[model samples]
Target: MDALQSSLLHQSALSYAYPLYRNLLDNSIVFLYHGPITPDLVVDILSLVENRLDDTGEDRRISKKLFNIMVESFSLGEDVERGHAVLLVRQLPYLYTVAIGRRIASSAVYQVKAFLDWVNTLSPEALREAYQRQLEKDDPRNLSLVGGVPAISILDLARKSHGILNYNFEYLNDSDTFFSLEARLQKTI
Candidate 1:
């Protein structure tokens, strides 16, 4: 066999592969997407995640809830690329964690931070109230481009899962910020 072929079967190569394999078995990975964000791309990613969840025998109700949360959070961009983004879905023994990362304009960082801060402070009942309020109002200014209430679904999902939404914004030079949010869905869901 050629060196390239032989190397593929070598202990050294297998050693490097084993950790990732073991991790997959221990903590299921639901989905991962890292690219320029787009509407079609979001739909495609969700479809793939749905199929994988089915294979793993995840509950349909929980799957749907998770899917809704993902769609609301990830599908908010315009047709044009809004810079590169990353979405990672991991299933652990105690929780399912979704982490999304994207680049945002430096100016909007405070707005996002304030919004997240308000969300983080809300209790489950308070979140439900806020979500209801958003749904009741149908003003053009309040409507999200993707339909449904903006940020309401995220708050509802977090409340339902009894989960936490943690967000961070790191300054990337003068004009951009690297924004990331990690949401944890409890195993009970």
Candidate 2:
């Protein structure tokens, strides 16, 4: 990767203990076309990370690094790619039948859980993830993760985690058919 790319990852990695930080990264990735990154390049990097239509056939370190580059680059400059990034992710089907759709939900679940565990062990004073209002929006290279797990699972995990964390997912069930994994736990616990 390039020097600019490496720097973003280095800064964000300091808060790797928090899902909010990763969420920040995911948020930007969800919309790579939001800053210096382009739609075609965003998809190219995302395809590497997501194993979507990429031909790398290997690890996605480049994509991951590019994510950091996208965020940090924009953070240091003005935002010119956010609109395109937002549009692309907004158009993706989180619950569709495509390869990304099937894995996104499960992968989202894993990313959320991993982030939670990581933060649980950290001293709250040492970090800050998205607590309220919105998720990640500070950095540019972070790249939002529009195609994580299904919205159902993401919302379920968020709501279930609310009491334990500062973020909440009350609006998750905004969809009539949506439900959290906590719904069952709420009854049992």
Flag regions of model 1 displaced more than 4 Å. 1-30, 76-81, 138-150, 153-157
User: Model 2: residues >4 Å from true position, as ranges?
Assistant: 1-104, 129-143, 146-163, 166-189
74-183 per-residue lDDT for model 2 (tens digits): 22122242121121221122210101111113324445556544444544332233322124342344534432322222322333322232221223232211112211
- The candidate maximizing lDDT is 1
Error of 1 at 3 (Å): 33
Instruction: Report model 1's TM-score to 2 decimal places.
Output: 0.72
TM-score of each: 0.72, 0.21
lDDT of 2 at 174: 26
lDDT comparing candidate 2 with the true structure: 0.32
- CA RMSD, predictions in order: 7.2, 18.8
